[model samples]
Target: MSRPALPELSLLMVDDAVKAALLEDFGRAGDITSQATIPTDAKATGVIAARQAGVLAGIDLALSAFRQVDPSLDVSVLAQDGDKLEPGTIVARIYGPARSLLTAERVALNFLSHLSGVASATNAFQRKITHTNATVVCTRKTTPGLRSFEKYAVRCGGGMNHRFGLDDAILIKDNHIAVAGGVIPAIKSARAFAGHLVRIEVEVDTLEQLKDALTAKPDVVMLDNMGPELLKQAVKINKGQAVLEASGNVTLSTIQAIAEAGVDIISTGWITHSAPVLDLGLDIEIG
Candidate 1:
């Protein structure tokens, strides 16, 4: 089946990241093994193949790595991001100088496999709550340098993105409430400091806090660690006042119940932080 159209990520957007990864792999010595063993003129064809079932992502970024290593390398993308693949799927074809292909293989696979893993994991959560109104959203818990790429992968897997960073939105967590004396004070402080355009979301751990947050009239209220029963009551109390988000201790076994409790968004960190890397291999055919 054809893949759905996803937003185009320009090479410029990922160039720095790809370059940093290549630099880390190459160091100052370069691919010494390839230089010593392979003939400089040798050419080869290679395939990026999946070893297991997954949702494909980061094909372009992977290609960028090869291009950065050798601009003359030819890469033909067979599958775009967001496409579901069975085991042994060929994602892309590469033909290039054997030395360049060998040098870029690991760095390319690192980006492709890790982002595909995030996409696949996010897809699993998205599939679970297909019947519900709750949207699966990713949290700020992501690889330090790859948040944008990881969030893009989440979108590819049909998951929504929460705040990109603390600067973009105001989320009053438990610590903020504690420091400010209460939820209302925290929300008020945020409102006073933030511009009218900034959105204020307060996180509450109990019904009492929820009531206080409701009184503050923040843009959104996150129901932290609330079970299904409390979430239902919170939903009813909210009465369409603010967007309700359910978070904390969320897992595949419990997401459905949380979603059924009528929250607008369900946020989880595992999709970005703990997703296992997808198994993708690059096999080269020497010519």
Candidate 2:
């Protein structure tokens, strides 16, 4: 499948918000060392280089962080979002005041590293699954304020994104199941309450519940915590009736096995929430 396109203006706007947050993080004072050691009039050039192999993302946000510190800074992108990078690869080049560069360094690195980590994790999961028609997907397991950027990184890493927010889709989870007393009732209430355009997905923990959910004709069915062998059986039972999404306790080691079971989508929380930060750094080029 082709990569999804993100609007340029939306990306820029998100970058602006991230920049504001970074400014709040620093307040009036800047990096004390750069402020003390670097001349106020000092001009410097540098590169934000990756220290390890990983997928690159949040290039725009990093650039915006630097620009917020100093708009006149000349920023050039050597790698775009979704680009896979090797160690020592220069992802971006910046020429500006030494102080602005130093001040923006942490915020920029923070976003870059986190986003790269998400993308890296996502790519590894996507690599699993050989024959079955299953797409790797991400859940709401994202950084609180950075959902858009993190989901964008998921897309960059070749994984599909679930609903960006609760408003975007209706997922009747276990709590909904309890409130309604069963999967069928929950799905029924969701269908009755949801707008005409809204689609309802229901989560089922067992084949019996899956059957009930299928009978109710949900838009999607989430097979919660089902292992690969069981998932294959569920897929057989589904037989294209509704989109099948396998979720819970997913890991890189198990993803390929799960995907081969023929689930339509696999949602893993670890990609965004548990991935370690990809190491990156910005080193000043002395002139």
Model 2 / residue 156 / CA error / Å = 0.9
Which parts of model 2 are misplaced by more than 4 Å?
1-12
What are the RMSD figures for all models against the true structure? 1.7, 1.8
TM-score against truth, every candidate: 0.96, 0.94
- Runs off by more than 4 Å, candidate 1: 1-5
| 10 residues in a row with least lDDT, candidate 2 | 2-11
Model 2 compared with the native: what TM-score? 0.94
- lDDT assessment of candidate 1: 0.93
lDDT of candidates 1 onward, in order: 0.93, 0.86
Across residues 1-287, which tens digit of lDDT does each residue of candidate 2 receive?
65567434286666767767786777777577887899999989988999999998888888878888889899999998888899999998899897888888888888889988998988888877646678888889887878888888888887888998899889999988998899988888888899989989999999999999998999999999999899989999998999999998789788888888888999988888998888989998865
lDDT of 1 by residue, 231-280 (tens): 99999999999999999989999999999999999999999999999999
